[model samples]
Target: MNELLTKLSECIEFGKINMASPYPPNMKGQEGADEITRKALEEGVNPQDILSLGLMPGMERIGVKFRENKVFVPQVLMSAKAMSTAMLHLKPHFLSGAAKQKGTFIIGTVLGDLHDIGKNLVGMMVEGNGYKVIDLGTDVNSEKFIDAAKENPDAVIGLSALLTTTMVNMEKIARDIKEAVPGTLVTIGGAPVNNDFCARIGADHYSPDPQGVVEFLNTKFA
Candidate 1:
């Protein structure tokens, strides 16, 4: 069972989606995350174990590589794709309450900022680490974020902005979310934002990369 879980982790780490996927040349034809996860479930592997052991570790590895510039967006996206393939099998268990999620995360690109690559990467990374991600997409407004926070009271909000012009929107959205739903945590990120901006805006956390976001969430909900 442990061996099976390790193999599943490798499949994610290398971006092996399925038996027929040809992204990584050396891993061709081997059982990928899609097949392995389904098989693990059939063979009585616990769904939660698959998430904590198989999926999270693989995502962590890729995220670190990305932070160090050892891997680029394509590799990270492929790893996320592989992890998502495995997630489809586990999602039913999650819905049935047989498996547990760490917490809920509501994410969006701040208003007037139509960028989604950073937002999407963070959402995928957060979801891969076992949080339920509610992606509000680009050009999201303060009211939309506040509403989502109200619906999921315990959820953490992540605001992303790639433009300096739109960063002011993030500050307002974070303040609005907190005022509308007291005690909700807000984490901010993007090219123009930093820890100082986070502190200035009264947001809870600031991470430079997806791994930093994942690590922050883990610390909060652990």
Candidate 2:
């Protein structure tokens, strides 16, 4: 059983979606995340184990690789794809509370920023790490962020802005959420933002990559 779980983890790490997927050519035709996950569940492997042991480890490894520049966007995206594909078998368990999530994460691109690739990647990484991610999509503003924060008071908020001009809105959004929910945590990231900007905005954390966000969440919620 442990061996099966390990194989499932490998599938996610290598971007194998299924038996038919040809990605990561080295693993061509091997049973991928989609199949391994199902096999684990059918054999009565705990869904939570599938998440914690199988999925999270794979995600953490790929995330660290991404931060180190050992892997690029295409590789990370394929890994994310594999993770989501496996999640299909586990989603029902999560929804039914048979499996647990670490916490809630509210993510979006700040106002006037139409870019979603960064936001989506962060969402996928955070979600794969066991947090329930609520993506508010692009063009997000303070009002929308505040509302979501109120609705999920315990959730950590994440803001993304690819354009320098739009990065200013992160400050306002962070400030607004903190005011609306005095103890809420805010994390900011993007091409034009950094720890210096995060400090200036009073956001709780800033990460250059998805792995950094996952590590921050683990520390805060551990």
| Candidate topping lDDT | 1
Q: Which lDDT value does model 2 have at 157?
A: 94
- Cα TM-score per model: 0.98, 0.97
In angstroms, the error of model 1 at 192 is: 0.4
lDDT of 1 by residue, 6-105 (tens): 9999888889999999978999989999999999999999999999999989988888888999999999899999999999999899989999999999
lDDT per residue, candidate 2, 68-161, as tens digits? Answer: 9898889888989999999989999999999999999999999999999989999999998999999999999899998998899789999999
Show where candidate 2 strays beyond 4 Å.
none
The lDDT of model 2 is 0.91
What TM-score should be assigned to candidate 1?
Answer: 0.98
Name the lDDT value of residue 211 in candidate 2.
88
lDDT of 2 at 38: 93
CA lDDT scores, all candidates in order: 0.93, 0.91
Checking candidate 2 for backbone clashes, the offending pairs are none
lDDT score, residue 201, model 2?
Answer: 92
